[model samples]
Target chain A: MLKAPALEARARAISKELRCLVCQNESIDESNADLAHDLRVLLRQRLMAGDTDQQAIDFIVKRYGDFVLLKPPVEPATYFLWFGPPAVLIVGAVGALLFVRRRNRVRAEPAPLSAQERQRIDVLLREPN
Target chain B: MRRILFIVPIVLFLAVVTYFFVAMRGGYNPSVVPSAMVGKPVPAFDLPGPPSPPNYAGPPVKLGFTNRDMLGRVVVVNFFASWCVPCRVEHPVLMGLGPSANVPVVGIAYKDKGQDAIGFLNEYGNPYVAIALDESGRTGIDFGVYGVPETYVVDKQGIIRLRHVGPLTAESVAREILPVVRALQVQP
Candidate 1:
């Protein structure tokens, strides 16, 4: 069995990563809402009472939903929440790269100035000077 | 043009990150009253009072009253539980408000056993006129109660004028609840 202080520290660390179900977005550690505070106290008490780390998390998850986890489980139903952003980033990067390459390839190279056009340009430059 | 186009994805990414950060900070404030429920009459309720226990030494009161009994009188219906810590914190505030606020206050013992509710009232000093047991939370559901320590102020006309969603503080009572009661008193 871990010392009480060690157990408390571990509990705090775990709770900081868990969202308060009642508050939705707040980690259990940071929320001052009554439910959040109650959950934190409960977590600490359970830890002191000899619940293992997994047991503690499982206890909360059972009562609340998977929503209580800050990092949601990478299950089939939650795959989008976990992987959607990175997938968007990768797709955006690839799309942008492809667009730039296509634009470069399709850019109209300035029509090479013919000899007559060059001479006319030279005359215009001289006249301007 | 390419450089500007490149910045779009980055900007979008930044916006998504900012949203997540704001959400993590719990930017959604819970105290704001929902506009939909505001100015609307409170849902009707006729809750059964908790079962009277043997040797219950608290206030002598009956069970089952109508909304009319609550209206035209400044009344507070507080939802509380013995396990809730905030209920303990707000008990004295409710007690103080009972006599001074010119209103009758009632208690809704939510999701707790009768014995526990009686014991809680005994320990806390029954500040309520009557205690209703919401053992199954059906009454609380009718009132749309999300949690314990919620106080509702019903107008003389039986409309729920205001809901204080959390623990009652002295400042909130003075600033919010008192003015509403004062207005209700002068209604013709």
Candidate 2:
């Protein structure tokens, strides 16, 4: 049997990772919102009542839906929300690299400074000295 | 040319960092109150008043007509539950506001039992003038209360001036709540 304090601590740790369904961004541990508080209290109660960690989470998930999870399951429907950020980052990096390479190629063929421009620069440098 | 290349990457990195910072700071926006509710009229709600003395625990006396009568006053409705640790942290701040501030402070006991609510008030020192029992959470639903310790400041005209979706600290009370109350008091 889990000791009371240990159980409470475990519940709190799990709650910190779980989002409060009512307050989308806030964890059940950090949010003082009613639902979060209730969820926390319920979690503690469940822990004390001998519910396993998975059981406690499953109970909440059953009631509140998957939206309460911060790192939601990567299922067919949520494939986009879960993978979207990293995918975007990869795409952006590749695009940036391609753009830089193209720019480098264009710049590599740079025409030598024109004779007229070089002559003007030489005159300006002499006059300044 | 070298300097431009260096500066471009640095600027891009800074921009990405700043975006994450802002997004993290704002956290999540719950669907309870849309951005439109800001500076809009507060929802009209008339709940039971605080319990009376002898049995009177703290702020909320009893459920009565007078409790509902205070509707037109500039009111601050706070939702709290005994189990919420952050609510305990914010208790003193609410207690201090009762006598000092011009607004009427009311408490809504969200989904808590009467005995527990009374015990919580006795232990923490109630700052609310009246505490309504939202046992069924019906009142909470009406107020768009997504969480406990949320304070809504309503004007005399019953327009909600501000809805703070977290615990009220001294700094927040001064910065957010006070100014709105002062403005509403002066308005009509």
Candidate 3:
């Protein structure tokens, strides 16, 4: 832990962004894994050495790749990961709209029950015993 | 149009099923994260041998190696620990690598006590041409090692070509390690 509270807080913030490679699910800040501890220590050291937050993050990212970041950066390979859900939602919404519109159009007033159909209905009613 | 629309859900369901079927058949293990260091030059660090030399049983040997030592030679760098169970299983395979493969195999004892590493090496027959003690595991972090018993094949230019996670099996030795080392050796 750093002696300076501000620095320590900064360190903690940075650690939260890094995924503990061993634990996979937990951020380095929350992990008890040895690797996570080391990374936490490394992050503090980098901060103390006057590295900007980006530089410190970049240091780990360079070693471990973008997977180390809790939030993956936007890139060509990750376009699907970032946009696929919204794209699916938009497509689904459009499909539902088209479906509902088609249903509404089919149900609309039934062409006022055309005159010929009405007359047939009347004839059938008059023939009933 | 409605007929086609009715089939859409089935088509989507089948697509999802096919995706899973292919992934399952491919033997995908989610835990195996690919190394980010491949194709990059080895991380810079100077690591030393075990603190006390008396534990070693073998003939006197070069204790440590730096990134510079890796240049101009194809070498296999292995990260192992005395406490790591799989490393013991992988030990004999490492022992054979030095002689049968004819390439220098370097060892970095990760986060292990100097004495324990020396003891492990003495008991198992030392396979490393050069051994480095990574007591703090700073070097291991630089190499992006998440676990023990990870192996890397470095090319003559000191760039990391391959990283084998987990204990190396004989099949992996025959397939991944030997082939990469051989290919790197012939390159000028």
Alpha-carbon local distance difference test for all models = 0.75, 0.72, 0.91
Top-lDDT candidate index: 3
TM-score of each model, in listed order? 0.53, 0.54, 0.92
Q: Candidate 2, fnat value?
A: 0.12
In candidate 1, which residue pairs get closer than 3 Å at backbone N, Cα or C atoms, i.e. clash? B72-B156
Docking class of 2: incorrect
lDDT for each residue of candidate 3 in B1-188, tens digit (9 for 90 to 100): 76998899999999999999999898777888778899999999998888654344566666877889888999999999999999999998888887888998989999998789888887887888788899999999999999999999999999999999999988889988999999999998
Full-model lDDT, candidate 1 = 0.75
How is the predicted docking of candidate 3 categorized under the CAPRI scheme? medium
> In what order do the candidates fall by DockQ, top score first?
3, 2, 1
lDDT of 3 at A129: 94
Question: DockQ for all models, in order?
Answer: 0.04, 0.08, 0.74
lDDT of 1 by residue, B54-106 (tens): 24555566554655567657678889999889999998989888788767888
> Hey, what RMSD does candidate 1 come out at?
11.9
TM-score of model 1 (CA atoms): 0.53
The better-scoring model by lDDT among 1 and 2 is: 1
